[model samples]
Target chain A: MSYGFVAPYTALVIAFGVLPALYAVFLAFTDNEGGFAGIANFTKVVSDFRFLPAVAHVALYLVIWLVALVVLVSFLAVVVHAVRVRWLSRTLRFVFYLPGALAGASSVLLWLFVLDPTASPVSGLLHLLGFSSFVQVIVPANLPPVFAIIAFWTGAGGWIVIMYGALNNISPDVIEAARIDGATAVQIARRIQLPMLRKWISYMGIMSLAAGTQLFVEPQLLSQASNAIVPNDYSLNQLAYQYAFQQNDFNGAAAISLLLLVIALALSAVFVTRGGLFEKD
Target chain B: MTTVDVGRPARRRNPARRRNSVSGWSMRTIIAVVVAIFVLFFVIPIVWLLLATTKSAHALIVDNPFQPGSFGDLAANWDQLFGFQDGAVTSWVGNSALYALGALVITLVASIPAGYAMALTEFRFRRLLLVLTLIVMLIPNTALVLPIFLELNVVGLIGSPLSVILPMAFFPFGVYLTYIYFNTSVPRDLLAAARLDGCTEFQVFTRVALPLAAPIVALVAFFSFVQNWNNFFLPFVMLPSSEGYPIQVGLTSLLASTPAFNPSSAGAQSVQLPTLALATVISVLPVLIVFLFAQRFLVAGMTAGGTKE
Candidate 1:
């Protein structure tokens, strides 16, 4: 009966999720003409000129994204918790979350207008910074950080909420006891809360790393919007997308995807071992 | 879970304790400034989006970009957006609704029961199932698109709605959340009592557990809906025609035709910035509205996996 209850979801997972992943692994070893090439496709994909640069671009973007997200979300969560003002905290959470409501493509498009100096609401700030054009604003040196900002805008709020929930789960008795022992709010956050949040933060870090490596929509759409001046092969996922869709190299795409899957699997291993995500409660 | 007692003694001492522990004025000022900056960071782009929708393309480029334009201009922008490609925006919106809702139903039906079974039953390969779900949940959706596309193509389902809907239904995060919910919140004693009363396992779940799982159900439904609705890569790869696009993909096509994004497009002359902004606004409105209404459940859903018993 219990097996019967689990049957439908298991079937769906096997059919759609597991089977496709296995198929992807199989496809990665085969050539375009369906010949089993025995790692030739992997070798070719790794040596593709755009592959290394795309990897480097995503690596830089991930650093900026991880740092900004952790700092901002932790800071906001601590401050919002300390303030203890109900309405203010709720409103801030909602406002931060508003961008998440416009998550995938919409957030990317919104940032395009925001980054365009002539069409942006922050045009005054852009002028002050000596950015008179979209090209000036989105220069090569600024692309990673700019992408980080966009990703942060759309991604940070949900993490903030999760961090806040973690903070809330901390027994107030511990906080009160610390307060009685003359610990300031900052000290309490640094000494107690931050240490307590180690697991959640690790979880955040691992998940963000996995997601950041697959950065696609923002860079892809930005490249499209900027008339390809932004470089269409701006990230690993985009490179895979380009190979599969544009060049009709499905094998190369599968190989690149397999690389990303390995990375994801490595990160998940780290998360499970270090973050204790699946420990028996 | 010790509820922080903030009633009499703690409330009476909090102000004094706060002042003594931290310089109240300076700390308050610092918090205010930091929060204000973050608020502006989050709010400015959205506010700009709203204001940008009201202006003409020329005004969007030439006028004070932050300032509001007339409702008359807004109406004109609406007309241009609806009039583009002979009302294709409407079809895109309808397609999005159909796909999102269809996937939402399937996700709820499949994920909820699966989660319930994992939590409540001693099943074969239970640990394997749980671990697999976590791993699949962690893998980026984009990574699977190529293989799913190939599979769909092999089956001649490319350009069909099932290509999108069927894949969207396999939401592992939903299953994980529901698993956590049932594991932590649904008591074992209740199920045992139902079993003692001669209820079968399915009957215990349906009659006893389902009613108590409303919050988790809502949480799963809201997330699955948003994910399916905002999903771009899968549909973009699977659905080949503009006629089948969800609003997110359709907006990209509109962007391709807009002069602001693509100067070389022949349709660029007809599509304007305001119209594009309006299309963006229209595309996101449903998710925003859902978020506004179902935020309580969303917050609960997002945090469910984080909290340990």
Candidate 2:
């Protein structure tokens, strides 16, 4: 009876999620003609000039994104929690969360304007930093962190809301006891709240690791807007996309996607083994 | 630490607690400043979009970018935006609503029952299903886009609404959110009582569980809508015609035409900056309106898995 209830989404998941994933893996091993080419596709993709640079670009982006998300989100959550002014906290949360509503393409488009030195409201600050044009602001070397800032602008709030909820989950009795014992707010945050947030921080880390490796939209939009001043295949997913759609190299695209899937699986494995995401009561 | 303990006997702790309550002036100032910076970080770009929509193309290039332009220019911008390609922007908005709402209904129907089964039932492969859901939830949606594209192509469904709507309906995160909500909030005793009273499993789920699942249903609906509405990659890849394009995908074509983002485009002269900004505003208006109305549910859905009951 319960199986009946589970069947619909299970069918959907298999058709949409699992079967495609397996098909992607299967396609990765084949040549364009449907014959098995073994590791040739993988080796060819790795040797492509864009491959290592794309990997490096995403590696750097993942680092910045994960670090900024964790540090900034946790810090803001604590600070917002400490402020304790009812309206201010709610308003701040609402403002922070506003960008989340603008996630995906719209936020990326908005940041195009924000980063365009000529049209940006922050043009004064951009000029102070020695960037006088859109191209200068999004140089190849600056793209990762620039994308990180944009990612943070739209992405951080959702995580902040998550971490803030985690912060509020701390039992009031524990906090009351700490307060009665004369622990300062910082001490409470540092010694108590931060430790309590370990599970959530790990979850964020693993999830961000997975998501950051698939970085596509920001660099894609930047490259598109800047007319490829930023490299078109600046990240792994964009490379995979270009391989599939642009070059009609489905095998190569599948290979690159399989590599990403392996990384995702590896990260999930590590998270399950070490991060306690699915710990049973 | 020793100082506080030793001084406790000589002085009352109430002053210290009171001090804690009011924090120091310096800390308050710092908190206020940091919050303001964060607020600006989020607000400035959106505010810039709003202000830019009110300006003419000439004013956008020459005048203070931050300064608000007159409302008359907003109407002019609206005219240009709507006038482009005989009101393609309205068609895009309509397509977005149709696709998003259609996918949202499917998401609710599929996710809620699946979550109910996972949370309330002891079944074969339940643990496996949960783990699979978690892993799929974590896999970036973009990673699946190409493979799903290939799948849809094989089925000859590419460029059809089902290509976008069907794929979007399989929202793993929504399923997971519903799972967490049902697992935490719904009591087993109630289900057991229904079962003991000879209610069939389907009847129990339909009558008892469904009524109690409103908040989560709303939560899942809000998330599914936002996700489907904001989704760019899938629809961008799937839909073949401009008419089938959702607003998010449509915005890119609009961006390509705008001179500010693409200077050498053929439509650059005709697609003014304010008109493009107004298009951006219109594309986001549905989401902004949904958010304004359903923010509580969005928040609850977003943070549902974070807190352990």
| Model 2 alpha-carbon drift over 4 Å, by segment | A180-182, A272-274, A278-281, B1-28, B195-198, B266-269, B306-309
Tens-digit per-residue lDDT, A182-251, candidate 1: 6877889999999988777878888889888888888878888878888998898888888988998888
In model 1, the Cα lDDT at residue A69 comes to 87
Q: Model 2: per-residue lDDT, tens digit, B69-103?
A: 99999999988888777888889999999999999
Tens-digit per-residue lDDT, A1-281, candidate 2: 87888888999899999988889888889998899999999998999999999999999988888888888889998887876679988888888878877877788888888888887889999999999998888888898888889889987887777777878888999998997677877889999999998888888788888878888878877787887788888999889988988999999998998899889878877775565555321
**Please, what is the TM-score per model?**
0.93, 0.92
lDDT, residue A104, candidate 1: 80
Q: Give model 1's DockQ, 2 decimals.
A: 0.66
Fnat values, candidates in order? 0.65, 0.59
